[model samples]
Target: DQQVKQNSPSLSVQEGRISILNCDYTNSMFDYFLWYKKYPAEGPTFLISISSIKDKNEDGRFTVFLNKSAKHLSLHIVPSQPGDSAVYFCAALARGYTGNQFYFGTGTSLTVIP
Candidate 1:
């Protein structure tokens, strides 16, 4: 099932500006905790994240906020740069019948214009 979705497939932002990415999940049971960034021909890397118990988490220029009531989450990048251009994925940890499972959004491709 497609529990998570990124409505915007792509986003373009000017360098030194702010970039925001949004994601929504259908399953309320999902315990969202991570955002990932993927570059060309590389593995996805952990970005910023918010635990289910907390509404927001920040790391360097990245921040992730969660709205559990609305099943929505977002990632914010300040002063976006060309190197920041990549595919971003929002993921959640779902405690399934068997064990802990991860659900990921389709991903949103970001373009930062220098």
Candidate 2:
């Protein structure tokens, strides 16, 4: 079962436009949500994170929103740039004493057309 799912395998947008990526989870026990960006052959880098206690978090060009009732979350990037083209992975921290173990979605590749 896919506890975390990024429905869109890929997304394309024009530069300077807004890009929205969606994710869904089936595990209600997950308490921490994170978004990571990765380029080919490199490890993912943390982009933003939201704790279950909070509904939203933002950093510069990126913002993440969580809706606990729907078990859904989304990442929004404003003024999408060519540099933002990469795979975005939505991850959740497993419940119990797992020491911050993360379950990742397959990932969504974003392409910005300049």
Candidate 3:
């Protein structure tokens, strides 16, 4: 089974609203978490991240929250804009078969409408 997952395949929001994306992980050993945004025909771009020790991390209009005990995390985009529409992926770094590696969730596609 995948260590990380994004239950929601897609989401839509109005241009000036808040967009919320959720993610979950099964590994308790994960210490670092990151959110990446991807656009068509290009690689995923790093957005923001938070350490497991921190509950919340924010950058401009983006924020990430983590619940260690629950092994859950969420990304919030405030005042969503049309340019923000894209595939958002959540990733976690944890011990792996050989060494530490990053595991990524499937992804959540967000659409900002006017």
- Which candidate achieves the best TM-score against the true structure? 2
TM-score of each: 0.95, 0.96, 0.96
* Backbone Cα, N, C clashes tallied per candidate: 0, 0, 0
Clashing pairs in 3: none
lDDT (10s digit) by residue, model 2, range 4-87: 999999999999999999999999999999999999999999999999999999999999999999999999999999999999
Question: Which whole-number lDDT from 0 to 100 does residue 96 have in model 3?
Answer: 72
* Candidate 3 residue-wise lDDT, 13-96, digit = tens: 999999999999998989999999999999999999999889999999999999999999999999999999999999999877
What is the TM-score of candidate 3? Answer: 0.96
Candidate 2: residue pairs that collide: none
1-114 per-residue lDDT for model 1 (tens digits): 788999999999999999999999998888756899999999999887787888998889999989999999999999899999999999988897899998899999999999
lDDT ranking from best candidate downward: 3, 2, 1
Error of 1 at 36 (Å): 0.4
Off by over 4 Å in 3: 96-99
Task: After the best TM-score superposition of candidate 3, give how far the Cα of residue 8 lies from its true spot, in angstroms.
Answer: 0.3
Q: Each candidate's lDDT (Cα)?
A: 0.92, 0.96, 0.97
Better by lDDT, candidate 3 or 1? 3
